[model samples]
Target chain A: MKKTKKVRQEELKKTIEDSPFITDEELAKRFGVSIQTIRLDRMEMSIPELRERIKSVATQEWNETVKALPIEEVIGEVVDLELDERAISILDIKPEHVFSRNNIARGHHLFAQANSLAVAVINDELALTARSSIQFSRQVKLGERVVAKAAVKGEDERGQTIVQVQSFVENEEVFSGTFHMYRSNQ
Target chain B: MKKTKKVRQEELKKTIEDSPFITDEELAKRFGVSIQTIRLDRMEMSIPELRERIKSVATQEWNETVKALPIEEVIGEVVDLELDERAISILDIKPEHVFSRNNIARGHHLFAQANSLAVAVINDELALTARSSIQFSRQVKLGERVVAKAAVKGEDERGQTIVQVQSFVENEEVFSGTFHMYRSNQ
Candidate 1:
């Protein structure tokens, strides 16, 4: 019985190595055990459930490009940031960054990227966006890597932080905006 | 010759209507003209080129619900609008109408929508945004359509118009924003 159990465990690990997406039923059948037993084994191994595994995969893909970077690298590369009382972020638009036939940068991406950069600069573990506003001054076009710059504008008595940011394509300024973020007390 | 041109015109219109994505080569071939000619026609109609057109379609789709209403209806929905000394615009957001995911409304959408509304309210033939500043206060979530109550904030002595606006998503106040719009003297 002990030899059989040991063999089953070895087979389970090998099965996992063969395909990461093994089902509980399949594992149970291979081990001559109940589905619940297979699940327990999975749990003991610190393997997430199906939904969690899928979510982790997606998160991994997303982090591959943007989220994996440290806050400092994100602030510097994605949004050229200038920190002070208020944070300022600048993003330069490139041809590949445009979403419109006119080659203009998409408004949402511009705002979100700038906001993300601003959030990174906050000296806190948890930062939340409270509000924002922006204006598109000129249409950005293809082949233009507009520089987006952000700066800290001010902070309120309640500790809410305000940041100003701008994006420029070519020599022309394309978009300018501002954001407010809140940090929870750790 | 006129009959031939009419046939070509019908074909071109059909291509544009049948598929929102009409390649320049296809259009040129149908019209028996150069790609440049098709481009010129598109420019004359204010239709952005391929990539821009694709982006416009997508963005329009996302904002379709809001844009479906007449401009007058938009004004009726929002309250407390004022023009500043420099013709800048301001608006207020009430908590009920903000997006659920980001408690605060998106900054670009706010600015672009406000700028468009400001243009509609203005006598100028063309209005361009130059700069802006925004601050967010609290989380304004789903079911809240921010009531943008605004006034003209300040005009730089350089003939720029700055508009200040406040927004409340439902009962919780969301954000306050200012926009700078430039109108051609024409």
Candidate 2:
């Protein structure tokens, strides 16, 4: 038997909420309804399209995982993060991130990428950096992608947890830092 | 005697370049022209208004002082910087920088402010961080203005320059860091 419109729309809402990246065509097939009906149902329900929905869900998930800070504050797009273990992020250098005179990437941008990844890898309610030792091994240019990796390196006698961060442009190391973090137990 | 239109416009451009924050009304008074005429001249020259002009000049000056990196890469607006000496920047956390559920400022934003400031204080064509020790003293809230100060602490025997950075929110210290930098003279 065909489902009623109200019941179908409710199921549609639940499906989209569960998998926000599902396309309209896929939804139409799943619901045994026309693409127009799916679009109409979405419009009536005030649900955005797949792209917007995916972005919203991704942002929310990122916020949840990043207990120490807001995800938007991260210098780069974090692709993976395992609390108290390892994390990875990627930064794409744009024209604005290069010196107009030299077309070279700024040193601080690399540091921001590494430092933020270091902070993000910690599993704590509040993680604070107490100290770091860092080095820039190479110069990065505009239009390059810098990948940053961060790993937790255990704690010290003073109860300070250490995180190591390294950034690379392609296969070459660009920057690295070791951050000592203070975590607040809640 | 009144100046020619061409000469007057040229003078106006020069004056604005010298003081980007000057108002159109001030320009009119100085040039003995109506505010409308000043606006027209600015329009013809494709010069933006006072606010845009100030932002442009400030960004350009900040870029020039930061030889090791691009100004756009800085996490905040760097208002002042002296090579191998001291630098200052301001970051105004926005709604997007906080978690939607809670309006707390992200930790990475604070780290970016301090880390970038540390790199900006170095006097070199190419500078990179080797290590750093950082601390977050307090939680920063949304819409807060973070002011970061960076000072050079001289170089070690191995030619690594040390920079110290402290970030404050309304005079309360929120974050602090020490950076070791490597400079390439060539």
Candidate 3:
């Protein structure tokens, strides 16, 4: 009887796959079962709860053309890294990595690329960025290669671990940034 | 004779406008002048000196794009502003401002937006971020509005002003951050 019910639920779900509004009541009625039963089946199938399902469909319809816009060039490459005194990877930046018009890389991109590399170095189940700050010196030009050397700065008063990163383009210090990533509950 | 030479210089500049690679020696020979004269013309036009100019052009062509792509809806709107003693701004998060399936705002956007607002509120002609640290309490969700409040925490040893910011969603504190931005010489 249990197997039979599972098969019925799967069939009903497929039938309503095209429906913008799939409700527990509708599925229950179609399968001649209580709404609770249909809800259990939905959960077992990993279907989002009603509110999330609604949001997903609405977001899809509202932003069909603009989902997951790809970023072409990731600014800095990881050449060295470290976490909590553990060396992980290192990053390098070349003159070809900077903006030509101003010779300064866009601040946010530099931060993001460096932060992403920092996150990548962490070997945790989940790591979330908490904060970051950066400083830029003189202009970095083409043909000059920069290195991003990082180290764990310190744990803050609130227990956030501060990571310091510096980028040197062809021996000239071009950029430096720091990031904080939160480690989830152990 | 002076008028003729001026017209010839204009023509040469126009030719190089399309192809900046036109060498000073080539321009001087073509215009019946010394290389020094062509170099002077280039300098007067505010073009980078030869070595720097080549580097600039090549860098622009190569680093054609190093953009900071915004991850969808990971930040909220500024709802309040206070620019005394410490620059501050309050922000609220909407449901769409979440990053992952768990409905938490990405940590980086939260800090970036708050830090940018604080720096802007400084009303200084030039300001650049220097360093920061932050911590997170809990995850934030969609449809739950958040409040981002900021203040200047203190100055670092290097004299950079550090600002503290916190974001609360649904009366529950979600994120808190500190930022440092440098005041430029007027």
Candidate 4:
């Protein structure tokens, strides 16, 4: 039985959404189609490759308002962001992020994601850190996904923009930070 | 000419201060003495070995009050601590801490040291981080020593202890934070 292109594309979209990390080769094998056909279907459906798919979900138009760190250089993938207001990012802990013995993700990686997200939220051409206070509530182990949310809380006496970020692994809060950012414009 | 014991000890202390990272082997070569002699002189003057000296210069007693994480587990070496009031820690970035291509130390290593020091400060059995605000003033590179100082501020309305931490690399400030901590007693 031959599945039509319309049905195949819809099924492909559903499969990719269910497992965003699934590779093209695996998708081709599952669908019983040539790899070239899978690639063509993905292109026609406006779906990105595996790498981009992981970063593209739940994300706003990222490049326009973000001006601080280059998108590639940002610690985590920015999923949602609004200039001078709020932002959100997600990081998946990989083997490189953990201690070889404990498999616990290093604390600094959590901080970097939170810190970088805060900076991107209020980003000017350059945003220097003035100060911050943070706490690690729980340790994130390898394979945990950390979602960091940043909110701009008014200004301090020095006119530094205060951005607060909280990171969660599932429903549990793992880390949180409040950043005093010195924006080039502000 | 053989140097007197007093002169040798004085020069050794001065040398260690001038270059905190200088090894005893180097010092032995400079003074034309055995490594044992250099060790004896350092002990006589109450000067710690090269590793300890780097952390001990501006520190208070460390082992007494810290209760959050084990002493060895603390990210940076806790140099000065006065449990609940203030604490200080130092970390020297090595090869493992930096990006292989750039030698730029990961932001999380700095944050880990700062976060651990803050946790150790209140440290009543266990202290959880409720929130924090932070800023990174500069990028820390491999081989740079970071000195982190944590000060416990007053409690917030919710009874969370507010702690501020600032990390410096030499005379330049690299990172700072104001941490809101949920202490067990509070």
Candidate 5:
């Protein structure tokens, strides 16, 4: 059965609202329409691209991070988030993040992104960073997008989940940290 | 022989500028004047109390920190800072540091205060946090002043200076961390 244009557009809005990370091509496939038609529908509805939606979601989580978009081409937009297994997030360094003289992003901002992601990966009602060992090999400048990859490396003797996160700029490694997260007992 | 009033006031301002942590009683004794006279001079010169000055100094280091002064009477303002030995700093959580629903301070702010102090205690031209292991024993609320004390715990096998920072809300321990700091050879 073919749906009317008005009904399809309404459903499109609802779908995007429910899953902000859906790409335009995927939406077009889902709606059984041409890619160009999906683009036009998005433009008419004033809905931003997939990238904008991901940034907005991150901003709601942490007010200060990711107001600055990826100024360059996104190599990949893969956010692999699996509870108690692995999680990933992207942060672009904006003017606010860098020093006025150096344009170098502050170390704490980098740490915060990794630390919060470590907590997010835990399968618990509440999770906190028990301890973390972090190292900054290279300085991240403004406008660089940092992709943080966190993997759970099994539990320790204390039953704390050990999460290791490594952040990279494009392909170059920028920062790495290991977080021992405390999870609430179910 | 007695110094002129103008000369004494000029020296008082310079003394406070050089050592911001000096007490009013110490200033009075040093200038050979009554404490009341010192107070009057401070009032006339529009110089704030020692507490205000410490907050202002902390604010300069990180713009978002310590603007919210300690609301209650300070138990101790002991910032026992010795380069390459130990250093201490205080941070008061304010509106920006807390959640609207629950006025609990965010975990990352606590980490920043401790991490920055860990970096500051090193006697190098440039030092950074290579790694850290931190724990939050208790939740810190808004308006709570966290006193972070960092002490040098010698060097690791990797030649990294190990600094341990313990933060307290009054007498109760709130957070503690051990940081491996990277120091530049000067």
Candidate 6:
């Protein structure tokens, strides 16, 4: 049976809220409606396009984990963070991040993902790196999504914190780093 | 006495070649000519605008330091590089690099600049960061220009190469890092 317009719109809104990155085409396919209908429904509901939704989510969720620095300063999107414990961020490599000659991602992009996560996990208001050791296990290509996880190991005698960050693409480790951090109190 | 158009144009070309980041306003002031005249001379000489010129120089100079990894992977424009010795890069913080509310640059951008410079200074094609220690000395604002310098310290007993990278904004140190790099041979 064909659902009513109100019911369909409500469902569409729910779907988008659940998965902000879903495309209109995917929504249409899922709803058994045309792409135009999906777009119209989105417009009627005052919902933004996928890109705008992603940006909004990025900004809205940013304040939760970041205290020492603004959310925008984190290299990637911080999806989860527990200060002085653990944190996670996701970086989507775009065309601008790759070499035109080869669709490979720049190594710094990976490093940024891990480095920023390390900084975001610190509990203090001022967190900085005193030293770090990193390894790139593999080359990350363009369009790949790198998920970096940072875990706070412990504190040294000097009160500097140690954080371990590992970045993975499709569950494959691409980069890993151990950072010794300095805080204001420390 | 004022110089001829031909002589002035020749000198303008030399000045830009020496310092690619000079602005049109600065160029006009230096040449005692109108900005329009400087633009016209640049057009006639097929010289690009400041941004394009910077990008061009970055791509051209990138190959000089980067061999193992592609030049596109470097975060900032590599102005100078001496493999396994010293290197320098410049990063201009853009709007996208900062949080929307505050124009302060994200921490990752600084890290990327320093980390990439560290990677580029490695002589080997398969150089990777085995460990790193970094510090954010000050908060970097958007539109600020960061100049990062990387110098090789020495090698450890484990054969890991050490590189020190320091980033400055207007002669003020903003970020610094020490990287332990691993090459394929070592």
**Model 5 spans with C-alpha error above 4 angstroms:** A1-78, A99-101, B1-80, B99-102
lDDT for each residue of candidate 2 in B21-97, tens digit (9 for 90 to 100) = 56787789999999999999999999998545534543335544686676776778887777887888878889866
Per-residue CA lDDT of model 5 for B10-95, tens digit only, reads 99999988876566877888899999999999999998886676555442232222111121211224354566777667887988
lDDT of 1 by residue, B2-113 (tens): 3465565566666776655456876787677989877777766666665454344332232222221234423223322222321222233444323333445444445444
lDDT of 6 by residue, B57-86 (tens): 543354454765677778898877768878
The best candidate in terms of DockQ: 4
Stretches of candidate 3 exceeding 4 Å from the true structure: A1-107, A129-164, A174-186, B1-76, B82-103, B142-144, B152-162
TM-score of each: 0.42, 0.53, 0.43, 0.54, 0.56, 0.53
Give Cα distance to truth, residue A137, candidate 2, Å.
2.3
Best first by DockQ, ranked: 4, 2, 6, 1, 5, 3
TM-score of chain A of each: 0.50, 0.64, 0.48, 0.67, 0.59, 0.65
- Candidate 6 deviant stretches above 4 angstroms: A1-85, A91-105, A118-145, A152-164, A168-174, A178-186, B1-65, B69-72, B184-186
lDDT of 2 by residue, A75-170 (tens): 898876778877778788997666565777766567678877777777775665666666777778897777787888888777888888878764
For candidate 1, the lDDT comes to 0.52
TM-score-better candidate, 2 vs 5: 5
Tens-place lDDT per residue, model 1, A121-163, is: 5665556666666677776555444455556767866567776
lDDT of each: 0.52, 0.75, 0.53, 0.78, 0.72, 0.79
Give the lDDT of residue B66 in candidate 6: 79
lDDT of 6: 0.79
Best by TM-score: 5
Query: What DockQ does each prediction reach against the true complex?
Result: 0.20, 0.23, 0.14, 0.33, 0.19, 0.22
Q: Candidate 5 clashing pairs?
A: A131-B134, A132-B132, A134-B130, A134-B131
What is the lDDT for A52 in model 5? 70
**How many clashes (backbone N, Cα, C below 3 Å) per candidate?**
61, 19, 16, 19, 4, 13
What's the distance in Å from true for residue A20, model 6? 23
Regions more than 4 Å wrong, model 4: A1-88, A92-109, A118-128, A132-145, A149-186, B1-65, B80-82, B95-106, B135-139, B153-157
Error of 4 at B113 (Å): 0.9
